[model samples]
Target: MKTILITGASRGIGRAIASKFASGNKIILTGRNKPMLNDTAEYVKKNGGEPVIIEADLSNPQNVLSLTKSIDITQLDLLVNNAGIAVVEPLAEMTLENWQKTFDVNVTAPFLLIQQLHSIMPKGATIVNIASIASKEGFPNWSSYCMSKFALDGFTKSIREELREKDIRVINIYPGAVATDIWNSVPGEQNLSEMMSPESVAELIYTSVAQPSGTVIEDIILRNLHDF
Candidate 1:
């Protein structure tokens, strides 16, 4: 069975992805919330997968380093970088602390984790970065979020090129507006009905990872049928 490690696996798209892979593989989940991580582990077990939990706050550099140090990198078949945060404010109103925190979790942490894990990863192993549509286009009040995702997109592209010779697949998934708690933090009236379900995105991720060994789905863009 393939061994998968997913960061931010406590809720939303991360939780859905873990459940999708819970049939026969080993799933290692990491998140800052210990209680939510435990709940996710229980869900994975109920779905017939072996679950392991690693509590980590990716915003802290030391915690990110510790996470990789604790993992058996050689045995990892897939690594999903799904942990991220969004801070919504006009450019003039955005604080330096918020901007740095967004980059710390969304961009820097993923880079460090991949750098540490890629060398020990077996050939044909896959790395998936959960990015957002904001990576491509800028939003008015989403400066920090957009910048972080943009950086993540660049990182994914660079690594994909670098790892081509090694036969490792690096994929970037840009998912538009999903109905998740992430929106609760942003100041806006979201039409939840118009948003895509996290489960749908998770299924797409599962499909990409399940492709033939020789084939790699480089990028996937998922959006709701109707615009919000």
Candidate 2:
């Protein structure tokens, strides 16, 4: 069975992805909160898959690096760098601390994880970066989040190009307006119920990873059809 590793697998889209892939694979689930991470791991266990739960905050550079230090696992079939944070605030009023945290989680963490873990990912392995629609289009009061996602897009594309001689697939997926709690934290936001569900995005993530190795789908943008 393939060994798939996913970050932020505690709740929301992360938990949903874990459930979908746990059907017939080895899953390594990582997140900061121990209680919630254990719950996710239990679900994976019940689904007939082994779960390696790693509890670490991605915001800390050391924690991100330390995560793979002791891990002896090699030859990863898939890696989903899905742990990210978004701080919604006006550019002028955005504090340096908030911006740094957002960048650390959304941009730097993923880059570092992929850099450190790439050698173990054999040919035909896949990597998916969960970028947002904000990566391409900007929204007000979300400068830091938008910029970080844009950087993720570039990073994903660059990785794809750099590994052209290999069989590994690098993909970027843009989930537009998912019904995740990230919206709840948005300043003065209202009517979140109008957005899409996390399960929908999770389904897409599963399908993306399950695709054939020889086939490379560069980018995918999922949006609510009703919004069109």
Candidate 3:
């Protein structure tokens, strides 16, 4: 069975993606919340797939290492970098601490983990980076989060180049205004029904993973046309 590792599997698009692939694939779900991770694990197990749940604070460097060390599985067929945090504020008002925290969770942790696990990700493995439309467009009051995702966009391209000969596919997804908790955390007028659903984003992720080895969809921008 193909082993897929997904960070932030506790909620949002991450949870939906886990449910989509959990029926037939072996899933390794990671998040900072243990109870939520266990919930997803139970759902996956009930659906006839084996799921290993791991709890780690991705913002902590030591925890990132610990998480990697705990994985005894030699190779991961798919790795989804889905864990991220947003500290939205104008550049002038954004504190250094907020900027660092955003970078730590959204960019640094994923890079560090990928660096440590690169060798263990065998040839033909697919890497999916859950980015944002902010990665491509500058959004007001989203300076730190935007910058982090932009860095990830660059990292995704660079890594793809380095691993081109090995046939490892690196795909970046820019999801726009998904109806998830991340939006609820922000103070603004948001129409949940008008926004893109997590399930739609999850389906895009599933398609990217299930494609044949020869077909690599490099990038995708999932947005609600109504919002645009």
Cα lDDT of model 1 by residue, 112-202, tens digit: 9999888877888899999999999899999899999999999889999999888899989999999998999889687777789999989
Q: In terms of lDDT, which candidate is strongest?
A: 1
Scored by TM-score, the top model is 1
The order of the candidates by lDDT, greatest first, is 1, 3, 2
* Model 3, position 70: C-alpha lDDT score: 95
Can you give the lDDT of residue 79 in candidate 3?
89
Q: Least lDDT summed over 10 consecutive residues: which range in candidate 1? A: 219-228
Residue pairs with colliding backbones in model 3 are none
Clashes of 3: 0
lDDT of 3 by residue, 1-228 (tens): 888899999988888888888888899999988888888888788877899888889888889989999998988888899998888777788899888988989998889888888787877898899999999999889889899999999988899888777888899999998888887657678788888988999999888877888788999999898776
Q: State in Å the error of residue 209, model 1.
A: 0.8
Give stretches of model 3 more than 4 Å off.
Answer: none
State TM-scores per candidate: 0.97, 0.96, 0.96
Relative to the unseen true structure, what is the C-alpha lDDT of residue 128 in candidate 2, on a scale of 0 to 100?
Answer: 84
Alpha carbon lDDT of each predicted model: 0.92, 0.87, 0.88
Candidate 2 is scored at a TM of: 0.96
